[model samples]
Target chain A: AQRVTQPEKLLSVFKGAPVELKCNYSYSGSPELFWYVQYSRQRLQLLLRHISRESIKGFTADLNKGETSFHLKKPFAQEEDSAMYYCALSGINTGFQKLVFGTGTRLLVSP
Target chain B: EAGVAQSPRYKIIEKRQSVAFWCNPISGHATLYWYQQILGQGPKLLIQFQNNGVVDDSQLPKDRFSAERLKGVDSTLKIQPAKLEDSAVYLCASSRTDGLENEQYFGPGTRLTVT
Candidate 1:
């Protein structure tokens, strides 16, 4: 049973403070990981993926296979960076591949 | 190129009524997906299609939910006798079927409210 877990339902941080949103997964085989974000009234968009190893919007995530985590982090949070973030895993199950997503975490950066 | 398109932006219906939503994927995309996103939750994949053929539909509630992509161009998802718990935003996404990497592009979801 492959599953994604986003422990925090909501996280608040002051502007310019460092931010970290936790994410973990339970899977046996190698998994492809992704981060998606949805801002107010905007369509959901891809933020970044582990394979790309690229930072987007001043955020970066490292895949820690030993701990089964891919936590998203940012050095300095901005008010405009507040949004809902989801962690997803792509894996094979019963001869088919599917992307399973976590419940999601809402980040509120207060100025 | 235009992004995925879905309509109507919002829909309200009473329980036991039937409703349908439409999606038009990006030009030349070979894979399309439908997802359900409840408030405060991430989007859940209900179905996936490669061209006009169904690739995965294990999570779709067949009794009440049905979808079709007739010519591999446009798609539609229908719910007959909708339930109150069925209220959620329906999202459409598309990606190239080359199989190297699946980076899906999503559309503005259709918000469904079943009372």
Candidate 2:
């Protein structure tokens, strides 16, 4: 079974402050991790993936296999960065892509 | 490319009533998924389809929930005898294929309120 865990239900930060949204996972084999964001009145979209190792909108996440964690980090929080963040995991055993998502964290960036 | 599409942005019904939601995946995409997202929780996969064929539906409540993708392009999910607990956002998503890095694109979810 594959499970993603986002410990924070809500994370609040001031503008320009560094932000870190923690995410942890449980999977037996190698897993592919991803972060998806849902903005106000917008559909969920991919933010970043572990394999890509590329940052999007100043946000980056590194997969730590030993810790079973993939924490999203941003150098400076912006008001527009407030949204719901979800962490998901996928594996190849299913023969199809099935993402197991974690309970999202609502990020609130205050000015 | 156009993103995934779903109908009935919102739906309200009494318990025991039936409701259905539709979805149209991105053009050329071959896989579709139905997910149920309860308030304050993440989306949970209810079912998955691969080109009109049922691929995974282990978590779907077969007794009350059913879904189909007839032509491999569009899909529908039907919930018979709805329950209060069923009130949540139903999200439809699609991906080009089950490739190693194919990311799934989501549709603006249909919010269902079971009164």
On TM-score, the leading prediction is 2
Q: For residues A1-111, could you state the per-residue lDDT of candidate 1 as single tens digits?
A: 779999999999999999999999999988888999999988888899998999999999999999999999999999999999999988744344478899999999999
- Residue by residue across A1-111, what tens digits does model 2's lDDT show? 899999999999999999999999999988889999999989999999989999999999999999999999999999999999999999866656789999999999999
Residue B1 C-alpha lDDT in model 2: 75
Screening candidate 1 with a backbone cut-off below 3 angstroms (N, C-alpha, C), the clashing residue pairs are: none
lDDT of each: 0.92, 0.94
Chain B TM (all candidates): 0.97, 0.98
Local accuracy of candidate 2 as per-residue lDDT tens digits, B1-115: 7889999999999999999999999999998999999998999999988899988899999999999999898999999999999999999999988675898999999999999
On the 0 to 100 scale, the lDDT of residue B20 in model 2 is: 99
Question: Residue A88 deviation, candidate 1, in Å?
Answer: 0.6
Top-lDDT structure, candidate number: 2
Give the range of the ten consecutive residues with the poorest summed lDDT in model 1 chain B: B95-104
TM for every model, in the order presented, reads 0.96, 0.98
Give interface RMSD (Å), model 2: 1.2
Report i-RMS for every model: 2.5, 1.2
**Can you list each candidate's DockQ?**
0.61, 0.78
